[model samples]
Target: MSEWDAEFEVESESDEDPDFGPHGDARIDHAVASGTFTLDGQTFDVENNIWVVGDDAECVVIDAPHDVTEILEVIANRRVIAILCTHGHDDHVRYAPDLGLATDARVLLHPDDLPVWRLTHRAPPSGSLHDHQVIPIADVDLRVIHTPGHTPGSVCFYAEEFPGYPAGVVFTGDTLFEGGPGATGRSFSDHDQILESIRTKLLTLPDATVVKTGHGPDTTIGAERDNV
Candidate 1:
């Protein structure tokens, strides 16, 4: 067995919740680590869901929030490959530099959102993510689906038949949610563009595909498809 497999075997046997999802050779575990902080005089409750999707000792991080210490603790000894920002939102991208510095991971963001990203972040990302870009992590591949609306560069990460996750998973930043699409009242947001992006990019996925949002509880594509 591989080092990761050995670690998982010993850890899974004793751990009940295991911070894992699905169940099979390809195990993808996630922990929803949240933090409540005041940003721009507004008290924002951020739910940062960090996913560890791979079999090897190395892994990838999706969306770095303010509470990075918790995320780092959850990751434990695994090597973090990259820190992918779903959008340029300050709430989501804050502390990304700290996390990157701590983990020695590359930070990635969409090109269009750089302006908004710069509002809160001073340093540039290690790289930029484009539409249909595939990010490989051991046995899993996270497909980047650009769903601009919440922001000009907002993107979602999609994975098909990811080990323990059979229906697949989509890490939707602020582009989508349970009740409806993400809010577009901000300066760079557009309502029509967001609706179209969801209809074309997200709703097209299989009904069972899991919708993992940047905040709040998780939902399935089927549950929000008709609403879109």
Candidate 2:
């Protein structure tokens, strides 16, 4: 990948990567049950958010974020059945191996994002995911939507009725966000392709589908479509 394609050089990396860019609506709320944790940056400058699902019996973590110890401490109270990645960004999977070892949970991702993951961890995706594939992670039933844009294998996980909520929820890694979508400046990334993916794959979901973004606060498909 060229410098322009892989360069996500923000001035300073934080627990959260700044705030959501300009593509967000002021009215929609961005709150969800996903928890945040920290991690160490050995191979890369790992900095991102982590999300957790499930209640007392079992739970699944979305995005490793950074700081393995912190992530384990945060989810220490629950039984983690699996770990899922939206994409293979460094910050997203820095602690996945340790987390999976700690919980003995299966680590899963799209086959396409495996290369990106291997660049950091030296291994490919533990599992394979295809578009419209439904994966049951403990209590969470995730439908993998391969909306490649930010990366060739970029995907999002959607639950028709996310645990306690009546409306469906989508875990949009770096693909579809509140304000707009992820950057598609790489050789593998196509601007028109990502746009079309969002318009057709994501925007077609229910209006009330709650979106738990990879970086910033959560929003809904309806809001982004309307705001844009």
Candidate 3:
């Protein structure tokens, strides 16, 4: 694989090279949960991606999805720093509070999405997530970006300076996908705002940066740069 390893993740070092990137030992676990998503008086069946980032000792769970049990299984007794909410959409953060309570971790979300968030969840999030806020996992970082096109508080976490991905990786939530930007036809979403967010916030990243989405498959910045 090239220096910008976009696909398969290497667990250990090769004979040719011994050094892994910063916190190269870190692990990213993926799981999916199925449930109903409700927003703008519309409900649809959806499957949300549960991303566990960090090492065996401590990690951060991104997006609680439907089932807390599914997310906890991926967590597997690890110390969870926070249950990070990429957006306040029902499909993405449905069980955030449950997972946070289960793991004894804080549930964090961007305040701007509170209107949408309050529609489903009565209990508030543990705290607020601001733009450019840094979520530390081991030695790497999940840098927050306030990409508000998908929703008023939609954000993406850009993981970088870690092992394998010298070009870095991005947790797009619902802001971007393989074909183009995420849906904006719903309420509190604007086509022009989403286009601007994709153009300025996401498209500016490195070409090889992997795009991990809220749903569907993963793509890279380079592959999506021209399309967006």
Best by lDDT: 3
| Every model's TM-score | 0.83, 0.74, 0.88
List ranges where model 1 is wrong by over 4 Å: 1-25, 36-43
Each prediction's total of clashing residue pairs, residues at least 3 apart in sequence or on different chains, is 2, 7, 0
Candidate 1 C-alpha lDDT tens digits along 1-228: 444334434543443213233222445567776675343456767666666565547677788776777778767897787788898888788878889999988677888999988888787777677787666676666788999988999999998756556789888988888988998776788999999999998988998998888887789999997677
lDDT of 3 by residue, 41-151 (tens): 778998888889888688888889888888888999888878889888888888888887888887878889988889879987887777776666766877889998889
The residue-by-residue lDDT of candidate 2 on 1-228, one tens digit each, is: 323112212211221112112221111122222333222332323235567765545666887766667777667676676677887766677778878887887676767877677766886545555676555544445677888877778888888865445678888888877788876665456788888889989998898888888777678888899643
- Give the runs in model 3 whose Cα sits over 4 Å from its true position: 1-24
Ranking by lDDT: 3, 1, 2
lDDT of 1 at 180: 82
By TM-score, the better pick of 1 and 3 is 3
- Error at 61, model 3, angstroms: 0.8
Q: What lDDT does the true structure give each of the candidates?
A: 0.77, 0.66, 0.81
